[model samples]
Target: MAIVKLSTTERRRLSVFFTCLGLAIVAWIFTTLSSPLPFIINEALVYKNSPQKKAFHPLQADTIKITIQGTGWQMLFSKMKPDSKPITVDLTPLESRNYVVLSSQLKLINAKRDANQQITAIDPDTLYFDFTNRLTKKVPVRALLGIDYQKQFAISGNVSIKPAYVTVSGPADRLQKIDEWKTDSIKASNVNESIATRINLQPVTEGNLTIYPKSVQVNIPVDEFTEKTLDIPVKLINNHNYDNVKVFPQKVKVTFTTSLSRYKDMSDDLFEATADLDLWRDHGYSTLPVQLTRFPPFCKIVKVSPANIDFIIKK
Candidate 1:
């Protein structure tokens, strides 16, 4: 190949360009070397293949806190890398105020990268955790059924619970709320026969509370066994112009099945029987009609045998 020779000016210009390039390369290298490496904070360094003796208990918290030291820029940008397995400390093996440090607890980006970079413990060497001891206690269970039924309707049935007592366990403070445990409200509206149902336990007021048996069976007795009658005096409607009107049935019988305690409070004035005088007026009759005036608040109307009776008017 034939070579072309450059003039003096061209060679000098080329030399100057090469010198500047070399200086720039050296400066870049110096800046890079002066920069600090990154550090990670609260990063976990997990170690696998740890001995069984070092395994943490199932009830213990799984996370650990750690602090690492490195260059400001490196620490700001670099992320902490942890092993696949968890870094655990065995609570069973630990003595009071004593902790075990694993060689693999902390890892650096490159051990040789910077000799100044280090791992340190921000808190005490050992962590203290208050673990609760599991305990079981039997507590009485109560059932709260329909106690707010309408006045006419009454609640009946066993309303009893199976395994009246339940076994509950948890932290001491949690177990204290067990005595207040109860079932949700149940309805016994217009019930005529016995009843049985499965009810869920009410929400617990405290955390960490656990009940051994989830559900309770409730038995209610809607006793159709005893029935009683209340004789209510019949009242006559407006008797303004009727000088010769009389009602065939002067009294009525109000029947209900209720316990003796509630029956005694029953009264004869609990029923109101009245004859409609508007119907007589509409039919061009000069006499007034009888009607049911008043009834007991606790009594319900079942049937009026003779709904209407004739009012005789003499001219």
Candidate 2:
């Protein structure tokens, strides 16, 4: 095939035509993307201004479809990076009515949003709720703990939580089942010292339920424990016969574990040991078992020497 060479004038004309075509295409694309458009996206719902006297449960899902008006670039970016914040819905109207209209609150809701992206409409414009008898009760607060204490060190006393009870209000059916509300876990490792801090209560997942005072103050006492031995006098009880009844040993050695702070205060007077005489009368038992009737709190009993005592009944 014979090659055809273009003249200098022809080559210049062809280059100018292609350049103008490229610029026109670029301008057209830019103008199209800059125009405002509407797009629909889903947003979670958060309720506020709830009525104190009424208990309400949503009849529909907790999500709403929101239509926003913005430029094509904003719409594309919104699709790529979605908004995670839930839309706050005012439930003040529910005091007199059982339903709320989302369109009525559009002006108030748009105040917090960016001016570039305005919400135009919402699907399911009317949100309805089912009403039931509201019930409020004071329930105990239980703390969940995970602690790793150092050797010879542990919790010395009972874990105390301020305002041990919290007020919970919800539908009667749900409130009746909740006897106690637990706080989030309190975890610690190498817990050699006492813990005094505030912890958050478990969050309410059901929108119908509400708990006052979301957090509580906790105080955990910690100390080192040591072994303590005491010689407690044994008492004879149920001496019905008009005769002398005596136990072979008047005192028995008792070993226990107690906190170091209270070690010096420990004494045999705080404990009581008894050997029941009825054991010999009721059953033909040869020996009476020594029983510890009382002891101080927070003390772990290790061993009670001479568990069984020999008794003599002289009639």
Candidate number of the best lDDT: 2
TM-score per candidate, chains pooled: 0.31, 0.67
Alpha-carbon lDDT, every model: 0.53, 0.91
TM-score, model 2 to reference: 0.67
Question: Where does model 1 exceed 4 Å of error?
Answer: 1-129, 147-153, 224-315
Ten contiguous residues minimizing lDDT sum, candidate 1: 50-59
How good is model 1 by TM-score?
Answer: 0.31
Q: How accurate is candidate 2 locally (lDDT)?
A: 0.91
Pairs that collide, model 2: none
Alpha-carbon deviation at 20 in model 1, angstroms:
57
Residues 104-138, candidate 1: write the lDDT tens digits.
33343224234555545433344433345556679
Give a tens-digit lDDT track for model 2, residues 39-136. 88899999988888999999999999998898888878878998666889999999999999999999999998889868999999999999998889
